[model samples]
Target chain A: MKNASSFCLLLVSLITPSLWPIIGHADGVFAFSPEQAIHVRTLAASCAACHGTQGNAMVKEGGNTSEENNPVLAGRTREDLLSKLLGFRDGTRKATIMHQHSRGLSLEEIDLLATHFSMQIRVIRPPLSPQKLEAEHG
Target chain B: MAEPFNRRAFIKAIGATGLVLASRPSLAMASKPPMGRVVIVGGGYAGATAAKYLRLWSLGAIEVVLVEANRQFVSCPMSNLVLGGSKSINDLTFGYEALQANHGVIFRHDTVTAIDAAAKHITMLGGTLSYDRLIVAPGVDFNYQEWPMLASLDAQKQVPHAWKAGWQTVNLRQQLETMADGGVFVMNVPKAPYRCPPGPYERACQVASYFKQHKAKSKVIVLDANAEIISKKGLFAKVFNETYAGIIDYRPDNAISHINLATKTVSTEFDSVKADVLNFIPPQRAGKIAQEAGLTEKDYPWCDVNFLTYESKLVPDVYVLGDSVAAGLPKSAHMATNQAKVCASAIVQLMSGSLPDVAPVFANTCYSFINDHAAMHVANVYRYDAGKKMMVSAEGGGVSISPNEKEAGYAHAWANNIWADTLS
Candidate 1:
């Protein structure tokens, strides 16, 4: 194994200075306590696998107008996020898999997630090109 | 008492040592001091997600050290497409650079040798590190106890398992490519409760899809240990019987009894199977690190954990994630990342003297491609059942009505977003 003890220490010393700006922007509008914020943020983070981190869903270059596009969630108005989520929950709207997810959460939790996502600063990434593959990756 | 290793003192020490510290831009100063350090083993979907979320949720309070044996991550979720010839191993492979550079996670490319849980220290091949909490997200390890002869590294190169999505994946693809027309390709599914329940069937579809387009005379035989198809049974059956009728032969309840490596033949109780290329996915259990750390039960192969925190029921302050955890759910990549988020949130709260969320709810959506262009999905939402102390599937969870080309785009998009989520 490669020893990186000193490098690890250097990385640690640099973390606080580099990471604070991304995280320090306080979302003071949450009606819940700080503890509840942790829970909701985690719940919202689960969506990142399909949606991009902070709900900025990735788009193929030149904009993919396919049924496959995952809707961007960050910076959407709170009312829109809540209504759409509630629709998915109450069967008022049709979806591929969103209903299954929305149905699992309570109305309050859904509202929290909606508010949480709306607060995120959406960074629509530069149009991404598909990854190219070769026979020998190494 | 010894002095606490405060940030100022640590930076001063590094400065004294003349070590060059890399930085981007200084931000608003953190109000709280460092709470603790978390050392995570394994850099797959689960561990990588946990490390990222722990830092993000904690606001740079808790330090994260991610130790992974491999420098690059190769996803198993899309590896089947490589067999279908629509993708390659290079497409699935990614480096940890973004995960480290962006998140400020201390990336250690090392292998764990031993774990002293009582001392809260992990002994790696390079050096020992102490942690307040440890997350063991090592994925499944193949169990070759039944056929020890095939366990060796050299033997694996000959009859590839190709289950873990690495060199063996490339090896298996090459074998399929070089096989003569009309040649038979045989693959066996290990018993259920293994990693990715639907993966074997998906592999069959991928191979059959390749044969249909290229080698029309080639045959794909699936020898499953289960009584029937384990997951998405109806959909897979439709694809096998209707989509690739003559090309695919799916035989259920035919577990491998013995293998003749010299002749590339496999024997089950009822019949003998001779193949031009053989892909045998053996039985699997919690990864070797989990077993060595005493995270798994004595009788069972998987680990038992507190459903809310994913902290091991066997080991205190040590959590298990991903396919290693014994759950009644499918061990898909999405499921693994969801579990990691829950675990990361719980640990952050626990470190800060706050209670972890009790009623954790998450969703799992897994897609299976019938061919290169058509795909289907099985989606479910899981809620923590306080009574059972486990995650149970919620209502409104179901499979796609049928495979379609539209869902295929969604599948690839899902892969892209997940790769970015876990790594970047």
Candidate 2:
């Protein structure tokens, strides 16, 4: 029975290392890595669902800009995005959903997402190859 | 997966790889890598994205198979527009062709029956297949016990939910088309945390939009079980007041205690509504496959997972994404696709014997097209909260306070982009 209890304890520990509090600062344990930065970019691309791939929603294809209400996040520096976010979180800057979204974000995370989006270039589509086009039409 | 590379070093190392990804997405997938088999059940947004990215990030080093019951994917995102007559069912339908051809993902058109997590295999109609890892993104299943009206197929056809975006969507549209002018079209909104909190409101808007154009004399009623509009509260309220005031009759906090299809009446505690058409979107939980696996523990409707990796807490090496995850975030396609990316990355890294990033960042967008012309959205970023072990909201989050026609253009592009990202 004692041996069985020890085995059960070992099984629980193996399955749920995540149940611990010190998430980072350990080996064989989950924490931030370089792959996370890449994964986070895929996360940021979700922004393109609304803000466009460049974070500028008003700007349309072929340099046409719409008279839209939301502000553009493209070409803005990391500091700019961070400062705005801080203001929203602190109630310094007025916003509707921004305040709510910025509520629990640590300063480090705000900087990371802002810095990533700040580096994004505007939209550019590669021309379709003639060979592929012919294969399609034929 | 090599040595313990910290966050900064890993980010810097992946930069050159990112260039290769941009230049040639499928170039890396040309050669198979060391990672073994990964089989994913369900081909909704989450499962599909997981399969595609697992191959992409693994650089074709792994064999990834996606088992989906349906050959074609019907998106719930713009499905409401089908009722409004702005878009068609085919417009939202996507096949696995590109995902198979371009991303090198294997597609199996089969429904998964059971998961033997301990044995690391799944049983289905064809045969049982073993995998190094299993991803379950089966979305949601409706709980139809409260309303006997939805118990029978005939009753379900008359009072369709139209939430899943296929035949039910067609059924709702046909009902609207056949209802007598000046007849009442009533839709009941399930309580909060149902798939797409904004969906019923969006459906109400779509029905009202159709009424304004096709059946101007008809009355559209929205009986919301929640005390208020659950998502995009201000924007939906504004549109209803300005655009759909006369057409849409919205009532809040009226939970339907009984739905009698025999008499075509829906009732709450004391009040009842008789309608020409009834749309009942019942309360929902995780898909049955997860339940059959015994993964839905402690009376939770969804499977509990380490949000960082989306691996089921109860079942090892078995991951759950999409609406099946019991995370606090809105049950949405946007969240599903993002969660899939995180899951895919974690699986690859873990296969290489590396731990996943604990403090991961993610984002979600809740977009609502008020009508054919005007649209609005609420978007937010999220980070892993170690204390709570959940992905909590982060910075760079906001919504459209003053939505317009131009934003409507953005909304359509978004649908196209999300579909391409998930499928292609």
Compute each candidate's TM-score over C-alphas. Answer: 0.88, 0.78
B1-424 per-residue lDDT for model 2 (tens digits): 1112133422332343445466765564544334688889999989998988887778766678899988778889998998988987767776777777666677787788888898888888877778899999999988886766586767778888888888788778888889888989988888878899888998898889888888899988888889999888888888888888898888889888887787779888868889898888989999889888977986778899988889999999999999988988898888898889889988988987777766677667677887788888887777787998888876557679766776676566567556666776
Off by over 4 Å in 1: A1-28, A33-36, A126-138, B1-30
In candidate 2, position B412 carries an lDDT of 68
Q: lDDT for each of the candidates?
A: 0.82, 0.74
Model 2, residue B51: distance off in Å is 0.9
Cα lDDT tens digits, model 1, B15-121, are 32222112312222332456889999999999999988887666666788899988778899989989999988878888777666656677788899888899898
- Candidate 2: stretches off by over 4 Å: A1-39, A48-138, B1-32
Q: What tens-digit string does per-residue lDDT give for candidate 1 at A18-128?
A: 223333334434455565566677678878777878798777675465655678899897656866776777667677778878877766667668777887777767422
Clashes of each: 0, 4
State what share of the real interface contacts each candidate retains.
Answer: 0.45, 0.20
